[model samples]
Each structure stands twice: as C-alpha cells, then as structure tokens.
Target chain A: MWDEKETDRKLCIICSKGTLDMAYPGLVLANAALMEGIDVTIFFTFWGLDMITKREMSNLKFTPIGNPHKMNFGNRTIGIPNAVAGFPGMTNMATSMIKKEMDKLEFPEIPEFLEMITDAGGKLYACRLSTDMFQLHEEDLYEGVEGIVGATDFMELSEDAQIIFI
Target chain B: MTSREIAGKTIEFDEDGFLANPQDWDKDVAQELAHEVGIDELTASHWQVIEFSRSDFDERGEAPTLRRLKVAAGVPTKDLYELFPKKPAKKIAYVSGLGKPHGCI
Candidate 1:
C-alpha cells in the first residue's frame, strides 16, 4: 500500500529566493503543473514569501543595491561585473529599460500572473517564520493563498510527492 | 430553476472593461485582464481574436510578432499589458492562442 501511494504521488514545491528573474519561474511552474492535473503545493520561505503577500506582491522592485546582474549601460560594452556596475541610479535605469521591453511584448506584470495561477485552482501558502521575520500577517497575502504553514506541516502534505525548490 | 437564456448568462469584455456578463470576476483574475478579455463561454470578440490569431499563425508559420498582434487585435500597447502583465510575450501569445499552441506557431 505504501509503495502504491508513493508511485502515484507527485508534488511540486517552489522556494523563491528573490532574484527578480528568479521569482517568475516558480509561479510559472506551479501554474503549469496545475493545468496538467497534478497535485501541487508551493512553500514560500525567506524572500520568496513576498510574492504571496498582497502588500509586497504589488510593490516588488528589483533591488539594484547589490544585484550582480545589473547592466552598466554605457559601460556594458566593457562588461564589468554587475556588482560594481555603476550605482543604484544606473541600476534603476537598466531595470526600467528591461521593463519597457517587457511591456512591448504584453507580458502580464507579476501580480496579474499570480492571479491567473490562483484562478486556475493552484494552491499557495506562506511560511510562518518568513512572514514573522518580514512582519507580515495572513491578511497581507494574495487572495487565493491557503494559509501559513511550517516546514513540518508542508512536508506532511507533500509526503511521497516530488519536491522541487525553485 | 430551469435552463433558459438568462440576461447575464454570458459576458463580453474588451479593453475598456467588463460588459454584458453578470458574473463578477472583477475582484479576481478578470480585473487583471485589460485587453479584450472573456471567460465562461466565448464572445464574438474572443472568437475573432482566436480565429484571426490562429489563421495568422498558420499562414506565417510563426507566432504573430507583438507588433503584428497589436495591429490585428486593435488595441493600444497598454491594453496588452493589462491582458498579460507577468508572463513573457511568447508565452502570452501561446496561452492567448494568438498563435497556435501545439507548434503551429
């Protein structure tokens, strides 16, 4: 019986570590899995928790403060490490250019895509510790969020299922 | 309760906002969709976009590039933003079926 359960079990887990580029992959994967009729569960930890919370989700900004992928524009031709790429202002400029290019293509902003996942019956959860660390509350999360859960609780639900940390 | 053509049975939505549907998805995903959006049953506009996009992709043998889709859809650039603000354009085109999903384009 245990073996049978294990064979049929499948789970998708995403741990969003907060690189602007990294955030979307988790969401996209979760949504795609749900469409395939697979049982999916998302566990948000640390900076990843922000995406599920409402106040943070809508106002997310790429921090150029120390981001290493930032482009130094005029100096980009020289290809310096993004960590030393100009200053915060320059980082903002690069991020803006990226946003504009994305805009032209009709990519839905982060929050919109989250809504799509929710509408499609995907389940979302927030980590209690992460929310506490960030000083967030259950009410702060996006509309479709299931609830706050700890690691043990999450693992139990994901027992015998495939776990992916995105 | 009986099956009948209710006034609010279906909805018609376009760039401006929701219209002709009694169901209120406004608080959720529907609000996020700003470009000719439709749900719970297809509308004429939805059919047009789907049909035109499919045909366009079939003829070109490639997804209709963003510029071309905008012109064909008859909406401002901001409209697309409202429709799909998160995923990339290629994924949007595929999801929207503005291009055929299974390799048509």
Candidate 2:
C-alpha cells in the first residue's frame, strides 16, 4: 500500500564547498522536509564535511582562486573574450549585502545550525572517504552526526528518497 | 525553465552551481531565495545566510516567518531598509523564491 514515487521520504546528500551559501541549502532542505512530515537524511561529503569538522568548518572562506562566478557578466552576455566586469567591488558588495539580509532573517550561525539538525529528527552522516582524506575524527563532527558512511551506503539511503548534492 | 513552473517550490543554486531543487525549506531558504533573485554571483556572506537559515531550521524545524527572519538573520532592519530602500522583506523573499510561491511547491 506504499507508493514509492509518491512517498514523502527525502534524502539530501550535501557536498559542501567552502562557500557558505553552498553549504546552507542542504541543511535547510533537510530540515524543511522533516518539518513537512517527510522523512529526511543528510550526507555531508567533500568540502561540505568541513561544516562538521572542528578546525575548518567555522573558518570557511571564499578564496579568489579560480572562482568563475567572479567573471564579468557583461562580457559573457555580449560574447567578449573573458572581459571582466566593470565593477571591481561587486564581489565584496554582494557578500556584504547578503550578510546583512541574512542577519535580518535571524538565521543561526554554523554551530547552532548543527545543533538544530540534531534536535530535529533528521539524521546527519559524514562521508567516510572525505573524512579520511581530511583526516577528520568523530570529534570533528557535531554531536548528532550518526557516523561516517561510504558512497554505497549513501546511495542505498537515497534510492527512493530525493537526493540533493549540495 | 519558466517562472510559472517554479511558482511555489524553492529553486536554489546548489553546490554544483546549477539551478537546484531545494525540495524543502527552512529559514536558510529565505536567504537562498534572496540569493536567487538579487545577485548572480554569491559572496561568502551571502552563503553565510544560507547556512544560517538552514541551521535555524535544523534547530526549529520550520522556516521562520517574517518577524523571526528579521531577528535571526542578524542585520538591523534599518540596514535592510537602507539596502533595498524600496522593497519589503516579503517581496524580497517572494522574488527570491523562499517559500511555496504561488503554484509550484
């Protein structure tokens, strides 16, 4: 009597980059699903696992190294050869603006968000391979993290659930 | 591809940089919604809201309404008052595709 396609179960696999924006969607989606009366799980992998780690999670930064988003939109829009945007301060400006906007929304900081996930019924798992590569231990993750899991385990959970690679 | 198709559901740019299907929303969804509309390129601070919004949901289990967002996001309402100068937070959230818009989600 269970319809797989119509099932409300969802799974989110978050591969967080150092970019905080990149990291937030996965957590938000996962918690949202849970709140909606759907079952949810989250798998943190790659740079995303940094959120669970101690030394690097809070210190996450956006480096200028090879960042394609910083390219000038006008050049791309007009078919120019990699012409950078006229506004040199665009990046900094956008960053500051969003930060202010977020502050108004009363969004929690990273550490508190981790606690929110645990307090919610959602499950948090760190990627075993990514953890090993990063030399992270269980202590590096937030308290609610279930454990380190491999891709196979991740896929198995995602089989019927919606999988989001954040 | 069309705006109508994305009416109610939240559409976000995922870690992969594609138009992502957030599938669900929390407080972070609001900021992500803002990111979707305001700027094409998001800075670290922009992403910080995304993280915080999600975290807010992780703790609270639901997206904060307008008033809560004002407090949780940490920006003085006056600060945002100056930034948009014209648009209200609800409009900003709506344009950003934060909650169930009108049809999709």
Number of clashing residue pairs, candidate 1? 7
Candidate 1 chain A lDDT trough over 10 residues, lowest sum: A1-10
Docking quality (DockQ) for each candidate:
0.03, 0.04
Model 2 residue runs over 4 Å out of place are A1-7, A63-97, B1-105
> Candidate 2, residues B1-105: lDDT per residue as tens digits?
322123355455433232334344444544444444444454464444445544554576543443354455764433433332223332333433333311101
Lowest lDDT 10-mer window, candidate 1 chain B?
Answer: B16-25
Q: Which candidate is the best by TM-score?
A: 1
Give a tens-digit lDDT track for model 2, residues A8-82.
556665665656667666666654554344667778888888777877666554333344454333444322123
lDDT of 2 at A21: 66
CA lDDT, candidate 1, residue A114: 67
- Measured against the true chain A, the candidates' chain A TM-scores are 0.76, 0.72
Candidate 1 has a TM-score of 0.57
